[model samples]
Target: MKFSTNELLPLVSRLDQLLRTAEIGDYPGAFNGLQIENQGVVSRIVAAVDACEAVILQAAREPGTLLLVHHGLFWSGAQPIKGILYRKLKAALDGDLALYSSHLPLDLHPSLGNNVLLAKSLGLTGLKPSLELKGQSVGVMGKIKPMKREKFEALLCKSVGGRVHLAPGGPETIASVLVVTGGAGGEVARAADLKVDAFVTGEGPHWSFTAAEELGLNLFYGGHYATEVFGVKALARWLSEGTGLPWSFLDHPSGL
Candidate 1:
């Protein structure tokens, strides 16, 4: 089954409003809405974290496929569209693959966002928006039944499906957590200021470790890629259910 871009506009528009794609501020490169257009129609949807060459080629394999991503192309800003960039664009144009990206918007989405999903995966309650970035709350803070630090770390490791680096700076028992998926480790000071028992985020700089220790905040680094897969997957599933258009997630992990 195929759907025209016009038919999909309402759904996409609804998402833009729900996610505040236009109102919310994002990095200039985020270019949050539809980035690439196809030949006016779509047959299947492919969701992935980054719009890298491999993922673009994969989506291109299926003509009229809309590639949904968190980090879209053009991160490097205005440069000659040659080499890898040229190849990616060529593949999409040749194969009729459309592309759409949502960065901060997807991260802060109330239900189908990375931060909220990650918090939910760890069974956190009393979830509330936190961590302002460009006047938008891009992180979530929530309460967890107080548990031993080790037990909480174990649960976090399980949630992200990989190794977790823990800075055991907080109390032996953890009762609350702040989640900001993807490279928010630099926000250790901000999380500490929030006074949450712990802070969960993707990779951070080396100093963040000592800072967490100094600030007495439990910090968990759960790999940027691993923690961010939630938004795209959830968005894809929601779209499929709402529009009856089949979709698939392209697993391309960047072990950071």
Candidate 2:
């Protein structure tokens, strides 16, 4: 049975509720819902890690696809609709496409979030929250037994499937490491607070390198796009299984 946009709204909201209960994002953060809607009839769906121009173009070509993304437009909250942004929105409006996004909530979800899922995929145990963001933990810290730094790096490289930059902090044998997916390397100091041996994340700032050096915590950069793709794909799988909408991933390669 086909589900109209209005019919699917509650289902989407239910899915969002699940994600929110799991602590997907800051929760209080803005732009967590349906950002744009069309004529209220959605036939096909496109799920991507980021809602970029390319993904929007793909959605446009799909005619009635509802674009579900991890990162939505208007991150800065408000911006003049002109240039590229204007073009993207025009494309969606002209094609009658709808847009929905989930950010930090999708990152920390235990079953389908980027950090926890990556921890599970790597067979990490004793997963706990990071110490950085008080009142809430946005990343997962865990134990990895004792392994050589090179071997651990090899594992991460294989898991992420790209060039990984490793900054070994302390001993060659690592007992515990922290995992935070996508642009979270800046929180490596949180690993120091927990006394973790290594930290794995998508990308980090220049200060992250210096901080890891001083803290004696190994740092690994797994390429933000590569690390973040899994969670949305997992979400798409859940949507297919739960709502029987038959979802497919719109793989838009992001080189960042």
Candidate 3:
């Protein structure tokens, strides 16, 4: 089923308001909302984590498709639109592929956001927002049955469907699990204040390891790309349900 971009615009706009993308702070490259305009007709919607060269080129192959992604192109600010970047743009435009990106907004969404989805996936109930970033609560804090750290780590691995890296930095009996999917290891200390026993996120830098230990927070480094898949899939499902357009996920994990 084909759907017009105009029909999807209101939904997208409502999502912007719901996510407070404009009110919230994000990278300039985030450029939330519609980054690429197509021929007003979108037949199939493809959801992915990033719009890298490979994903863009793949989208170009399927002309007239809308590529909904979490991290859109242009993270590095403006360039002359030449070389590989130019080819990316040309491929997208020439293929009539439209791109829409959501960064912090997607991460912080209450219902369909990545944090909430990740938390729910872990069977976490009674969730509360935590770890505010850029004036938004992109991280989630929740309770469990107070299992051992090892068991909790195993459950978390099951939740994200990826191997989890544990620092074993905090207490053995973990009562709470805080999740901020995607490269949030830098904020390990932030979890300390939330009173959670463990912190779950995508990948983080090396310093975060010692920091997690010093901060006495259990750190679980789930793959960044793996943890971030929730939001795009949720948004795409919502869009497909609302618009009657078929959708599929282009899951190309970076495995970071």
- Pick the TM-score winner: 1
lDDT of 3: 0.83
RMSD of 3: 2.3
Best by lDDT: 1
Q: Mark the regions of model 2 whose C-alpha exceeds 4 Å error after superposition.
A: 1-6, 21-30, 132-134
Give the distance in Å from residue 146's predicted Cα in candidate 1 to where it truly belongs: 0.7
Tens-digit lDDT string for candidate 3 (74-178):
676666878987878888899988888988888888898889998898878889988776666778888888789989888888888878898888999988889
Task: Give TM-scores for every candidate, taking all chains together and pairing residue i with residue i.
Answer: 0.95, 0.90, 0.93
C-alpha lDDT score of every prediction, in listed order: 0.88, 0.77, 0.83
Cα lDDT for residue 197, model 1? 93
Q: Which residue pairs in model 3 clash with each other?
A: none
User: Between prediction 2 and prediction 3, which has the larger lDDT?
Assistant: 3
| Residue 130 displacement (Å), model 1 | 0.7
C-alpha RMSD of each candidate structure in angstroms: 2.2, 2.8, 2.3
Clashes of each: 0, 4, 0
Given candidate 1, what's the lDDT at residue 161? 93
